[model samples]
Target: MNDRPYHHGDLRRAVLTAALDVIAADGPSGLSLRDLARRAGVSHAAPAHHFKDRTGLLTAIAAEGFGLLAATVNEATDLKDAGVRYVRFAREHPAHFQVMFAPGLLRTDDLELTTARALATDALRTAVAEVRPAEQGDDARLAGVAAWSLAHGFATLLQSHNLDGAVGGRDPEEVFRTLSGLLFRQG
Candidate 1:
């Protein structure tokens, strides 16, 4: 049990941290608000006070993940950089990544979730546009979708250890770069 003191919004942070830990270890299906409250060293009802229920908690995680993804990819210098950033975000935040895309587990209409998703989408679109100045409209949109699919598919495979033997000790990010280069041969 945590012996740390709780102040103001500390409980919310604690609960969120605990939830992430649980999700990291056991995936989203294993998350329980009661278990989170116990892990956070607070009353069982404490988490409910902040998140209302399991879906609400997952919604919060999804929103936070999208926001983090947007910020991460927004730092990219090019399309490959953006794809690398997306893969890195998934690798670094597997729990969040797993939860963020599971539409069935989230509050689809949640304002924060919708807003964060938009931010990530816009960032990816901007990255695609910046990379292909002549390719606008549907071409740019398709490029963004293709880039996203490649990065997302690679990240998911990497996370599941499907690339362990195939990568042959190469850094996953580097492997992603190689793969992205093959798929998106610029000029």
Candidate 2:
């Protein structure tokens, strides 16, 4: 019940990082602001300054996750490579991805979340541009959705162990590349 305010300059980031770890280890149901404070080594009420409630904390984590995802996906040299990168990001940052798309858990209206989502979407759009260089407007949008679906589905399947038996003895990355190739029309 320590009532001292946290003077740490980056309390918000600390709380969000802790929350992500907790969610990763125990899922969303195990997250608590007080528990985060304990893990963060801050006073119980310190988290309130950064996140008013559990939802606020979740929103922050989702926002950070999206930003990281965008950065990771955008680093690929080509659109097809970006799809592979997206799957890698999901696998490498399982905790972040878990919170990023867990519906109703994050505050979608929060400014940080909105901006992060937009950045992530822009990364997807860039990948689409690489695929459909000449197509503009609606066609590009459609292509983006299709590409995202392909990558997301593959990542989700891998994450959930849905493809374990199907791809026996094959590296997950190799499986992802093979599956992605089937879904994507290569030029």
Candidate 3:
């Protein structure tokens, strides 16, 4: 429908959904405000109003990603479950996963993004606490870092399809569970 009639109804959501579709199809580098507007059936300036610039849009996606991640991580029964969920989240939301890690593309100072990131971090740290005994200072921080690094690295590789054939036809989370077991299980 060329010359589409537009209304302000859910325009912001439409733009964000269009942005996700664009990111899913063409990667973040290919994202354009004009294209988002076209996809959302809004004026070019509409997207700009919602997200001041490209970085703002990316920041929105990153913030959304972290919020989703925090919710997923919180669903875990333990650290191993959290790791598995993390990988699954990456697999399911590839676009979000990609944008969430690329700091250079997003507005790092965005309050929503920072807050959502903190939520995700808190979720991860909660899982880490289950993985390691109660400890003070850097010890707990170190454990959380190590746990996050391992799970994140695995999720990244899984998202890139680096572990495609390794797991055969089995569920990816199952493999993640097995891998997580290696670290979660202590001697």
Error of 2 at 35 (Å): 0.9
lDDT of each: 0.89, 0.83, 0.86
Better model by lDDT: candidate 1 vs candidate 2:
1
Q: What is the C-alpha RMSD of each candidate to the true structure, in Å?
A: 2.7, 2.0, 2.1
Candidate 1 lDDT, 41-88, residue by residue in tens: 776777888899999999999999999999999999888899999999
- Give the alpha carbon lDDT tens digit for every residue of 1-187 in model 2: 7766566768888888787788778988899998888877789888998789988888888888899988987898877788888988888888888889975997888999999899999988887787776357887788888889988988899888898898788877777777777877655
Instruction: State the lDDT at 20 in candidate 2.
Output: 73
Model 3 lDDT, residue 105, Cα: 98
Q: Arrange candidates by TM-score, highest first: which order?
A: 3, 1, 2
Best by lDDT: 1
The full ranking of all candidates by lDDT, starting with the best, is 1, 3, 2
- Once superposed on the true structure, which residue ranges of model 1 sit more than 4 Å away at CA? 1-9, 133-135
Candidate 3's displacement at residue 123, Å, is: 0.5
152: Cα error in model 3, Å: 1.2
